[model samples]
Target: MSTRSTDPPPIRSRIDRALIRGAAGATAVLLLTSCATLSSGNGERDNVPEDVSTDITDEPVELTLAYTDDPPSTELVEGFTEQHPNVSIELQQTPFTDYVKTVTLSMSSDEAPDIAQYNPGAMRSLIPSGHVMDLEPYVEAYGWEESFPEATLEPLRADEDATRFGTGSLYAVPGALSVLGVFYNRELLARAGVEEPPATFEEFEDALAAVDEEGIAPFSVGGLEVGGFQVWNTLLNAFGDHEAYRDWVHGAPGSTIETDEAMTATGILTRWVEAGYIPESANATSDDDAKAAFGNGESAFLMIGNWAAFEMEEALGEDVGFFLLPGEDPDQVPMTSGSSVSYTVSSGTEHPDVAAAFLDYLSSPEAARIQLDTGFMPVDTDASTGEGGVLEEINSVYGTAAEQDGIVPFPDFATPGMIDQLTPGVQGLIAGSTDEETFLSDLQAEWDRVHG
Candidate 1:
């Protein structure tokens, strides 16, 4: 990827310092020092865009990596290994149900892999903490601009501090372009006399009601941990206060995650669950299990990311069809959170240039297509197409979103620890342990706890 303009002031100084450090080192400690100098750059290259560590020599050059169960992770990693034989990857995968916990905890330790899947919100945390090596200069010097997308690349930059390497520099890479869709079994929908996907929330409720008549779970949700919360958050991002979503994320002005809009949207889910549109046992379903239920046809509609495509295709064998989740904001871009599961040279990598080169290779669309078909739209806009044909299909269905300017970041992207609080609070709301007003109160209360 490449850029035309200079980085923001805060970011520019960080870049100068990194450049001053001179040639990258073969020893990990020296390389890390250079990387720490520039945390933020390419702030405007918004949406711009893997792993393998083959060696276990006492040299300790491994790039440890982690991911939740997404199909492409395995596929892409395998493919990446084929091209670069020396880079060995240590895989740590969690079920989609347990992914958040696995990812959240691993990120806090120095033992965190040299490269692990990380979200945009965490970039600020990791870079400021010096847990991740800044990729801004490598991105610029290597002209990552030629391959990476500006819109996709921008979110991962944290440019707030010059010495801290907090903002405006590249710390993570977007793993995939994740879009929200209502995955349905066409056979089941046809049986319900709903031949087509509904284009509005009112119609969606009607369909769920029809499905509930047969005693099937109408929608799937992982009630445990954050799985239960994503269902509500996806809706909130798709239809609620988006600016507020960002404000809450950036600690900006007038954050309204507690706004009536957010509450109303969440209330709708609680209403659905109470009305039997969702199963009472849903709170116990793991995220992967919940998504699996949809594949099993135990649920009629699964509000899921494109990553679920391969699972559906594998389980049902041509039984699945998908459409965007219709929401109150018809004018809004369909909800999606584009991610770059980034690769970074570890503060401890022994071969920084080789590690950086390997990371650069992993960022390519070629490497992305190999991952277990993450179903993310390639952040490399000009790059050739990939075999993960699922991404191509998602792009076709949701391409209309591009016209909306930018897809909103997932509610999970709004802030770290936000969803850890949100999921349980929302689950309690749906389960009747908390009312909507109280749900809102608990949510903000949790934010205060985490932010404190």
Candidate 2:
């Protein structure tokens, strides 16, 4: 979640410059292929079996994978190789900042990896290029619809144009899942005389006031990066209409973010900034800095995804706890933005059956254990994560949402350059340089630019 550039230059300066370059490069490519549809590898049918096979030949097979996320990807690969001794997987790791660009280029080459971590930005181009396999046949064969959560799979589905989502062919399957929530310092809350995690947004606000009164920074926010919009995103999930938000994020026709619910969510964020619940220095902070501040006990709360769980637990141990951002009403169905460290097979792979079997392994009970141990929500939502702790707390809350189909795609996924818009828009909001109307308008404008 940090995503702070290692360059000596400012984070915003670097990100903005990168976005401009990326957008221009993408635009040139898009124009050249605007008339194209998702290709299925020159109409040559794959040699994969129609039914999911339980046993693969004992003959040795080798695969190469390109990925960014570590814990899950590395461990998942280890788990897969352990099960099938005859298969060997080689990994090519890239930094998160360079991953999209690097993976996209490599995947387009004739020597593409057998499997690569799925990135929506790259997939927009890769899908239409016929380089990535459409996993519909495998999905049905493996009964992945029953194995993986529906919400997780929905975002990976796209039309032939690779424009609209939630329908058409599937592109990938999740190796591990994650959810967004609030990570709080248990000692800080107790010090402020708050007994437990707030079950409603009203109570959460009150806790913020109490903590502020106790001379503590209520929330640690990294307004300089994705951290800022992540806060706005959490609030929007709690306050907005889930289906409408989902439709907009998935590029459904006629979807819009300029709703009364979105206005209410934005107002709540602005009010928090004004109330000093979110500090003025937040705009200058990096996500790593914010997480450090919270872990060091300088702040009471940090809003982020489960990906931060390992570091927080390492830094704070039992002092930290997690809970979903509570909704406006206590009885409201819980919702949050979540995604997976998913992988896709290359159409160029010589061992299609071996590659598909590796994917199928992701849903197995053994892989679920590896997923939980690596601090990610398992693909099997019903998989047990053991007794009480921050992970248990996360699993309990995340399971409820997944069962109710409340996990929605993140807002930035709506468009390729949307993060550039969301990050800066939230930065302006915190700085009082942009009004609520302008912020919402900018978000909707970006959506229109991409989906129109």
- Find the candidate with the highest lDDT and give its number: 2
TM-score of each: 0.71, 0.88
Off by over 4 Å in 1: 1-116, 119-126, 129-131, 160-167, 210-217, 329-331, 347-350, 372-377, 381-392, 398-405, 449-452
Cα lDDT tens digits for candidate 1, 1-452? 01100010000000122321222231233222232222226532111121222222232344666765344455555554444445567788765445445554566564666566654444544455555666665676567755555555555666543221213677666544555666787778777777777777778778887777766667877787445666776667556765566555444434545787887787887777768776688778877788778878887877766666666767776567776777754554665544444444444343444446555555564554443234455555433333334445566565555445355555555455555656778778778888888877766665555443
lDDT, residue 112, model 2? 89
Judged by whole-model lDDT over C-alpha atoms, candidate 1 comes out at: 0.56
The all-Cα superposition gives candidate 2 an RMSD in Å to the true structure of 9.8
- Clash counts for all predictions: 58, 0
Candidate 2, superposed: residue stretches over 4 Å from native? 1-54
- On a 0 to 1 TM-score scale, where does candidate 2 land against the true structure? 0.88
Q: Per-residue alpha-carbon lDDT of model 2 for 1-452, expressed as tens digits?
A: 11212111111111122322333222111111111122345775332233334346567889999988776777777767766667899999998889788888998887989899888878778778777878877777678899998988998887767788777888889888888899999999999999899999989998999999999899999888777888999999899998998889778988999999999999999999999888899899998898889889999999998777777887899999999998878998899988888888887777666787788888877777777777788899888866568888888889899999889888878887788888999999999999999999999999999897
lDDT of each: 0.56, 0.80
Clashing pairs in 2: none
